[model samples]
Structure formats: C-alpha cells, structure tokens
Target: MQTTSTYKILVVDDDPDIVELLHYNLTKEGYEVEQAENGKKAIDTAVAFKPDVILMDVMMPVLDGIAACRQLREMPEFRQTHIIFLTARAEEFSEVAAFEAGADDFITKPIKPRALLSRLAAYARRDAQQEGLDEVIEIAGLRIDRTSYAVYKGDEKIILPKKEFELLAFLAAKPNKVFSRDELLNNVWGTDVYVIARTVDVHIRKVREKIGEEYIRTIKGVGYKFNTD
Candidate 1:
C-alpha cells in the first residue's frame, strides 16, 4: 500500500467540526488533506489540488456535494475522481441520488475509524495505479505482467488481493469494452462458481476505487465497461 502522506484528499462539508474531525484522522494516518466549506469551493479546491479521492458531504452550502461533484466531472483532469459521500441520510433515494450524482461510494456517519481507513486504503490503492506502467497488459493505467504477480503504475507498485489482481488483468486486456457481470464471471472467475451479480459490482467497485472512477465506466442499465480513452 502506498503511504497516506503521498495521497492528497479533498473533504467537502458545511460543518466545520466534521471537516476538522475528518482532517484529524486522515492526517493521523499520514494522508494530506484539504478542506472546502461549500459546494462551489469543493470544485475549485478539488481541481486546484487534484486530490486522489474526494470525501464529500452530500449537503453543503453554496454548491452542495452533488452539484460540486457534477461540476468536477466536467473538468478533464478529474474525469476519474473517486467521490464518496458522507451523509446522515441513508434512505434508498439518498443513496441512489449520490450514485446518480457520480459518487463512487457512501459512508454514513457517526464515523467508524477503522472501517473508514480500510475503505480509504482501498481507494488509495486504486489511485496509486493511475501512475503504473505495465506495458505487457495495460488497461488504461493498470499494468499486469503474467510473468510477475506485481502490478505497477509508473514506478509505484500496487498491492492487490489475488482475485482482485486477476480480475484486473482480465479486464485490462480489453479496455473500454462493455462486459456484463455474467460475462465477467464466465470469462474471469469462470461460470462454474455460482456467484451473485453483487460480487461483480463489489469487485468492479474496488477496481474503480483503486484505478480511479474514470478508469471504468458504468453503462447504466446495462453493464460495466473499461474506459480505454
């Protein structure tokens, strides 16, 4: 895992206390953290800082997290920003709204430090891959050399679970092409294993988390695709 100090993160929220609390823990873990008090500032700060991931509060003053995220999506530099919403609301609509607004994940507060760290680490792994350079099997930024289990981005290597690494290799071989969950199970995991479709989402979600959201695109109502461009 890449050290947190190497990763930059943007936090968007209306509450100063929440921002402070988050910053404290994030820093304690060695991550570089920046704060944006409202929706508009979140976009500006995120673009200016180019954080590895954004931990955004759904409700904020000025632009609000959802609006800010939409704006962020317009910037070419952040086409792949991993946006995780920090919200008090956990209703289905709220969750759907977050995803619809381009959020990558959701974490409802009161915060669980350990769980939060784990999720953040998972994202950081994805971010680190953005700089990888595995020429043999390249999918956007992820690299996989069948001869070696190691995956590198630029000069930095990414640590991944066995299944995760294999899954990535399978998908990177065909960048930006749509693949249904069933197809992936048959091609990557094989059809013999009767896995639920949620398993595919979970792995794809993790893949997007480590590789950046722009690294993959969801075809809404269809399947997930690798974003070759």
Candidate 2:
C-alpha cells in the first residue's frame, strides 16, 4: 500500500551504518529518505526537505536529540513535523524523557523493521492530512485549515494531532469566545462518549506546543480562548 506513494523522511543519526540502514529500509518501503549526522544538520535538512517525518537518534554529535527537538519545535517550518526517536536507550525514564522533549514516538535500537514501518506509517497518515490542508481560516499571519487539518504560521505548517486540531478548530471557530470544557466536549468531541473534561487540558497542551504558550489564553476559572487581542 505504501510502495506507490512516496513520503519524504529525514533520518538523523551519527552512525553511518544506522543511517544507511534506515535509508535502505525506508527507501525499500517507497519512502524518500534524507540523512543528517548531527542535530544542527537535522534541522537544516528538515527545513530544506520539508519531510513528512523525522526519525532521530537521542545521542548525536554537536547537539543531542532532546536539544534538537526543542530547536525544531521553535522553528515554524517544523512546528508540526512527526518526530520519532530511534535510539538504544530503552529505559522507562528515557521514554518519558522523549515525550517531555517533544518526541511523538520512540523506537529502540536493534531495529525491528516491521514495527518501524508501522509507526512511521501512522505518523504519515496524520501528516498527510496536514499536508493537504488548504481550507484556511486566516487570522493575521496565523492560519487554520479544516480541510487540510493543518495550522500554519505564515507559510510554515504547525504539526498537530487530530484531537488538537479539532480543539483548535473549535476554539478558533468562535474566536475570543470562552467555551467551557463541558461545552467543548459537547460540541467538539460529541456527547455520550463519557470522556473526561480533563482530556481537554491534554489536547490544549499539545496545541500550545504546536502554536505557542501564549496563543491560547486561559479564562482563569473557566475555559480557553484563542487570543484575538
């Protein structure tokens, strides 16, 4: 199914063998792969290639994966890129650390080709929706596209998950207006699902990570508002 359609991928690793292996496997799967030996190079390649996903190593020359992810998160070009770490560290602490550092997924070394392919496909499926988003609601330099399932800072796409996309769409659908979490649940997620109102906070956090800390303004004791002011 994936062989006919090609998706661009950036593989960041200091080891030539690992990079080659990823490139080989991904290419075999009909994905176009790019390589970077260090964190800075990874960022450069990401900007230049506009990859659908990034497979990164936690330990690299110059800057590490955590630092690299933070830097990429700051850039508008890569705001929404699906970043997965391919590393040797399999400790529980490392997994938590990866997510805290902005990694969408993590794969341990001694690579399992099938698992890597599956996870990468999942990321691509989400990003494909983002890449096609052109139904834009432009608010100054910011944009929200419901059809594409994408948000952009000027020309740079902001990577967001489906839940976060829906959350932002709901909030932006009525900009500057406060909709309590209960109301949001009723409207956005639909009723009768029995989801926690606290789930809104998790989606909001992910949204903020893509946009900015200040983009969604809290209404103190109520709900959230997309700052129109």
Off by over 4 Å in 1: 126-229
Best by lDDT: 2
Error of 1 at 31 (Å): 0.9
Q: What is the lDDT of residue 207 in candidate 2?
A: 83
Residue-wise C-alpha lDDT for candidate 1, range 17-108, written one tens digit per residue: 88898899989989899998888988778868988778999887777888887777656566556677888987767766665565666788
Best of the candidates, TM-score: 2
Q: Model 2: per-residue lDDT, tens digit, 1-229? A: 2332467889999999988888889889888889999999998889889986889999898999989988887775675567788889887677666666666667789887777887665554544444454456777457888766678897688766555776787677678999899988766544523345666776688788778887788898998888878
Assess every candidate by TM-score. Answer: 0.60, 0.61
In model 2, which runs have C-alpha deviations exceeding 4 angstroms?
A: 1-4, 126-229
Model 1, position 5, has a per-residue lDDT of 82
